[model samples]
Target: MNTIRNLFPEDIEELRHLLQTVYRAIYLYQHDRSARLEASMRAAIQSCMPFLERFKPHIPAYKQRYIELLKQPDRMAPYDLIICFDRAIYELHTRLKSGEIANRLPWSKELRDLLNERQEPAPESTEGDDAADTERVDFLTSGVGASRGEAAGVARVILDSVALAKVQPGDILVTPMTDPSFLEVADRIAGLITDRGGLVCHAAILAREFRLPCIVGCRNATQVIPDGEPIMMDTTAGIVTRIAK
Candidate 1:
């Protein structure tokens, strides 16, 4: 697909606006989907309440946590709540289908085993590892390459949209993540680096739309890379390297 890079300067500005509108629409669609899913989940949960009540004496703490979250959504993050609901539902379905709960087995142990099966092993620690210390002068961080190309610019660590004013025309944007709000400065950034996000994430989508070199899911780009330092993002190689002074 043709990107903003192929367009004239005036066309680039207009395209940016159009892309921002498209992103806004995508965000709205996601919001609506979440709302519909939440409603459907609530109804399903309500239908299963009688069955849950039967196992009230054997209900696990995680299941109870989901119940509590349903009662107090304000106390937990939206993503956390969604994950809790998902796990709870999965467990309920598994137990119902397998008839393990009907066998009068240890409920807590069964639930614990099920949860453990889905748990990912923790990543190996890289602490005190200086094997690459010599390369640190040039090698900063690396992540999944979301966009194609290379760019070198002064890194601007913008934690929020409020700090976007500090971004110059050719500055590279480093952040924990990007949302639709980041589109306001999309036309000005030379590249994008994000601590979180995958190939199809908001930052990646925006980078492709603008034909900007982008690295995402760096996990610690905001902390390891200092603001105002020159950095080179080679998206094709999936690396962001520091440009030594």
Candidate 2:
């Protein structure tokens, strides 16, 4: 498994090469069809300038890199590159499914069977026995106050993307950490708690953006807090209290 995992970087490099080749081919094909169409594509790409300018403040690193790439004479439009990448990923998937690529991995039969099994849906949450004991505090944890203010909501422990759907509007999002993917439910979450992260981490940045009460770097938060439990977070004090019920 370690050997197979180590090969992932090489696979990604191959994908990158595939993306570039596909992008170049499409660009040439467009140019051959009509120079006017090619010019129009460039113009369309330029039209995204205002949007990117506004978006730069929120995600400066990505926007800046994209801008730099656009400045290069040979660069294609951002959407075209995205499309090429999707195509490359699809091709890789096809090869893997056809046993033309992944079959070369020295994977054990157990591992192969596990990978082939259909993913089961997350289990339904049951109300805890203390659901009615709202006056009692079940647990307390602290961390860095990445965002300010106080919020009280039901804690929804999310370990991965598959568990994200369990989060509802105004819930306190509890996880080990966060990434850009968490933005999908950003608007719906009332507070954030992470087991790992510093002030400048992705969870912290997202909390600041939504002005949600956030406590990060609580090493045992996800383990201590039970799912569906009511919790109170005070970002100013960097404390989280699990309320009974």
Candidate 3:
């Protein structure tokens, strides 16, 4: 940690990478409840603090904040990355019908390092989204921003490009999460809602890039909200409340 924090220079990607290393095995250990993983991640990060403190050239604010986190102890959880990843892997297994695949575990080079030698970036995230699960309900919500916005509009849930091609002009898109693959139709949409990731997730990034209203991390929102129902989303407030329209 001291080596990564001090010698490596400070940056988001480096911090993200270091975090992946410290807590790489979090998802691999399946416990009774979600809280276990959350707590475990906090512990993992907390365990790195002493190393961070050893940097003699640290600035005042950085040192102060580091000391404060160590003081509180319980405030170390990184929700967006830590807990979300755990839930994401669990969701992935269920969605992929991952049965023995999950048990056997198909990991990438990064994940392998995290699990094997603790030397590389942990797998950023594994798949868990299937917004096209027509077996569920969807709420169309809208807000000022993409990430953390409320659900709204015509819930246009599609599996892939073929289904994406069928989208009507003013529909709200809902996806497990989006990659660069869906950008071609960005202008035709009113908004987006997602179930697999948080405000910092991919859909949020694209929404910002395209100036679109969107929301994410609704957590099985596809299963709870009914299709065609209008919603009031407040991204800043991290809310997606329902309303009649």
Candidate 4:
């Protein structure tokens, strides 16, 4: 870390390149793998504080370098980059400030096809052709039941945190996973379904407290369940059913 921080003075371009490389991994890992990588990175950044204390006076110089690079929209802001840096120090200069370290995963293209394709109303079937809009299985998929209960409500895919404000009472909150920030809107939703998590994750703890039905580790809930579609969360059986309207 000290060596990397030292590179900040070698040349502005080199520092920017290092920042990009670190953050790009965060961007792709969040999509392709999980948020745990981000969580770990943040933790490591926090660990660097003692070492960073000696460079306190030079922090502004480092930040100004980043600001100049960020002026080019192609270069992601350090905050949006999700690479580990001091949140408080960086927030002062970066436009992309965030308190939440881990972010929810969004629907993947492959999983979207699996859920939407089957539910799509088939074209009108002609003579000797397979019937269109044939009935499909009610339950879309299953996951680990984090909380025990059942809930039936419309699925609301929260691909971005901006949508948290729009969540309504009795709606099913579906996402890649939940972190501390998600609790802000947890009460409004009837249940929770996530693409990833385990028994110890925040979703499980919240479900138990809210007494809401919850299924984590679904792996594809976000892609499989379309926003505003009625879905049944059977936490007892760990199944999320997509109901035809």
Among these predictions, the greatest lDDT belongs to: 1
Per-residue CA lDDT of model 1 for 189-243, tens digit only, reads 9999999866645576557656788898899999989999998888866788888
lDDT of 2 by residue, 112-175 (tens): 4422222222323444534333234554677777777899999999999778988999999999
Ranking by TM-score: 2, 1, 4, 3
Greater TM-score among 1 and 4 belongs to 1
RMSD of candidate 3 to the true fold? 15.2
- Each candidate's lDDT (Cα)? 0.63, 0.60, 0.48, 0.57
RMSD of each: 18.7, 16.5, 15.2, 15.1
Tens-place lDDT per residue, model 4, 96-181, is 22223211112223322221111111223345632222234776777877777899998899977777877889999998876546
Report the candidate with higher lDDT, 2 versus 4. 2
**Comparing 1 and 3 by TM-score, which wins?**
1
Candidate 1: stretches off by over 4 Å: 1-136
Q: Which ten residues in a row have the lowest lDDT in candidate 4?
A: 114-123
Candidate 4 clashes between residue pairs 3 or more apart in a chain or in different chains: none
Candidate 4 local accuracy as lDDT? 0.57
1-245 per-residue lDDT for model 3 (tens digits): 33332343344345446545444434232212266665765566565555344422332353244344454655434433333333322233232344455334333333323322223223234266433433323333322233333434565665465667766677776666665456767888777767765434446645654556677666655655555555555555444555554
**Using Cα atoms with residue i matched to residue i, what is each candidate's TM-score against the true structure?**
0.47, 0.47, 0.41, 0.47
* Candidate 3 vs 4: which has more lDDT: 4
3 or 4, greater by TM-score = 4
